[model samples]
Target: MKKPRLFNLFLAVNGLLLGLLIMLPILALLLASSPVEIMKLLVDPEVLTATWITLLSSFCALPLMFLLGLPSAYGLARCRGRLRRSLEVLLELPMVMPPVVAGLALLLAFGRRGLFGELFSNLGIRVTFTLGAVVLGIVFIVTPFFVRRCTVLFDGVDKKLEEAALILGATPWQAFLYVVLPVVKRGLFAELIMAVAQSVGLFGAIVMFAGNLPGRTQTLSLAIYSSFESDPQQAFALGTLLLLISLLLLAAVHMLAPRDRRL
Candidate 1:
C-alpha cells in the first residue's frame, strides 16, 4: 500500500511539472497583448493572406496524403512479414527525420539547380520556391503521420468484419467503403485533425523549400515568425489568434469524432 501511494504521488508531481512547463509559455504569449492590438494584427492583410495560404496548402496536401498514404497504410495493415516492417519503417523515416533536414532533402531533389530541376523544367514546371512545392513539402512531412495513424486504426478493426462483408456479396471496394471505412471513421477524423494541426504549425520545411514569399508560400507559422521579427506587439496578437484557431480545430475534432472501442 505504501509503495503504491508513493508511486502515485511521484507521478502526480511529475505530471504537474510537465503541464506547467508546457502551459507557462503559452500563457505568456496570450497575455502579451491588449484586445485592440490583437484585433489589428488579426485584421492585417498580410496575416490574412498567410492564414489563407496555410489553409490552401493543408487542403492541397491532405488529398495527396489520402491518395498516396491510404493505399500504403491499407497494405501495411493487412500484411505480416519481414518486408512489412522494413517498408513501414521506410515510410516512417519522414516522421523521424528533422524537418530542416527534410527541407534540405527537398532542396536537393527539387531545387532550381538540383537533381530534378531539369526534369521539372522539361515538364514546364518549377517546384522549388513555388506554391506547388510548398504544398509538396507539407505533404511529404505530414503524410507519414496520417498513414501511421490510419495503419494503427485499420489494424485495430476486426478482421472478421471484412470477411463478413465479402461473404455478403460485397466487392472489395464496397466492403472497404461500407464496412472498414465506417468502422474506423472516428480514428480517421482524429488523424485528420492531427494532420491539420501539424500542417498549420509547419515552419522549417515551408521556409526552406518555399522561401516564405508573401501571398504565395507564407503560412501561419511563417507569418508568426516574420511578424515577431518586425513587431512584437503584432506578433503576440497573431499568436492569440493562432492559439484560438488551434483550439477550435481540436474542439471540432473532439466533438465530431464518433466513439469507438479503441484497442
Candidate 2:
C-alpha cells in the first residue's frame, strides 16, 4: 500500500514539474509584451506582411497535404508486414530529418540546378527562394505530422463499417466517402487544426528554402527571428502572438477529439 502511494506521489510530482517547465516560458512570453504593444506590432506593415505570408502559405499547403497525405495515411493504416514498416519509416523521414538538411534536400530536388532543374527551367518555373518554395517547404515538413495523426485516425475506424457499406451496393469510393469518412471526420478536423498549428510555426526549413524575404517569403516565425537582434521587445510580442495562435489551435484540436481519445 505504501509503495503504491509513494509511486503515485512521485508520478504526480514529476508531472507537475513537466507541466511547469512547459508552461512557464509560455506564460512569461505572453506577459512580457503589453496588449497595446502587441496590437501595434500586428498593425506594422512588416508584421502584417509576414502574418499574411505565413497564413497564405499554410492554407496553400493544406489542399496539397489533404490530396497527398490522406491517401498515403489510409494506405498506411490498412497495410501490414515489412512493407508497411518500410513505408512508415520513409514517410516519417521528414519529421526526424534536421530542418536545414530537409531544406537542402528540397533545394537539390527542385532547385534550378537540381535533378528536375532543366525541366523546370525549360518551363520557365522557378521553385527555390520563392513563395512557391515556402509552400513547398511547409508541405514537406508538415505532411508527415498530418499523415501520422491521420493514420491513427484511419486505423481506429472499423473495417467492418466500410465492408457493410460496400455490401449495401456502394462502391469502394462511395463506402469510403459515406461510411469510413463520417466516422473519422471529427478526428480529421482535429488533425487539420494540428497541421495548421504545425505549419505556421515552421522556421528553419522555410528560411533555408524560401529565404526570409520581407513581404515575399517571410513568415511570422522568420519575422520574429529578424526582429530579435534589432528589437527584442517586438520579437517577444510576435512570439506571444504566435504562441496564442498555437494554443488556440491546440485547444480546438482537443475539443474536437473524441471523448475516449482526448488527451
Candidate 3:
C-alpha cells in the first residue's frame, strides 16, 4: 500500500512538471507584447494583409481537402489487411516528415523543371511563387491531418448503419451523406477546426513553395518571421495573435469532442 501511494505521488508530480513545461513558454509569449501593441499591429496594413492571405489560403485549401481527403479517409476506414496498413503509413508520412523537407518535396514536384512542371508550363500555368502555390502548399501539408482524424472518426461509425441505409434503397453516396456523416458530424466539425488551425500556423512549406511576398504570398506565420528580423516587438505581437487563434480553435475542438475523447 505504501509503494502504490508513493507511485501515485510520483506520477502526479511528473504530470505537474510536464504541464508547466508546456504552459510556461505559451505564457511568456502571450505576455511578451502588451494588448495595446498587439492591437496596433493587428490594425497595421501589412499585418492585416498577411492575416487575410493566411485565412484565404486556409479556406481555399478546405474544398480540396474535403474532396480528396474525405474519400481517401473513407476508403482507408473501409479497407483491411496489408494494403490498408501500407496506405495508412503513406498517409502518415507527411505528418512525420519535417516541414522543411515536405516543402522541398513540393518544390521539386511543382517547380519549373519538375516532373509535371513542363506539362503545366505548356498549359500556361505557373504553380510556384503564387497564391495558388500557397493554397497548394497548405493542402499538401494539412490534408493528411484532416484525413487521419476523419479516418478515425469514420472507423468508430457502425458499418451496419451504412448497410441498413443501403437496404432502405439508398445508394452508397447517399448512405454516406445521409447516414454515416450525421453520426460523426460533431467530430468532423472539430477536425475541420483543427485543420484550419494547422493551416493558419504552417510556415516552412508555404514559405518554401510560395516565396514570402508581403501583400501577395505572405501569411501570418511568414509575417512573424519577416518581422522578427526587422522588429522583434512586432513579431511578438503577431505570435500572440496566432497563439490566441490557436487556443480558441482548440477550445472549440475540446467542446465538440466526445467526453471520453476530450483532451
TM-score of each: 0.93, 0.96, 0.95
User: lDDT of candidate 2?
Assistant: 0.91
Poorest stretch of ten by lDDT in candidate 1: 254-263
How many clashing residue pairs are found in candidate 1? 0
Over the stretch 1-263, how does candidate 3's per-residue lDDT look in tens digits? 54668889999999999999999999999889999998898779989999899999999999899899998999999999999999989988999989888888998999888888999999999999999999999999999989998999999999999999999999999999999989999988889888988999999988888999999999999999999999998999999998888889899998887666454
Off by over 4 Å in 1: 1-4, 258-263
Off by over 4 Å in 3: 1-4, 261-263
Candidate 3 has an lDDT of: 0.92
Candidate 2 per-residue lDDT over residues 1-263, each given as its tens digit? 54668889999999999999999998899889999998998779889999999899999999999999998899899999999899889987998999999888898889888998899999999998889999999999999989988999998999999899988999999998899889999999999888999999999888888898999999999999999999999999999988888889999999998878354
lDDT of 1: 0.86
Residue pairs clashing in model 1 are: none
lDDT of each: 0.86, 0.91, 0.92
Looking at model 3, which ten-residue stretch has the lowest summed lDDT?
254-263
Clash-forming residue pairs, model 2: none
lDDT of 1 by residue, 1-263 (tens): 54668889999999999999999998898788778886786678988898899888888888898889887898899989998899889987998988888999999989888899888889899898788988999899999888888899899889999999999999999999999989888778778887887888888877888887888888888888887888877778888887888888888787766665573
| Stretches of candidate 2 exceeding 4 Å from the true structure | 1-4, 261-263
Q: Candidate 2: TM-score?
A: 0.96
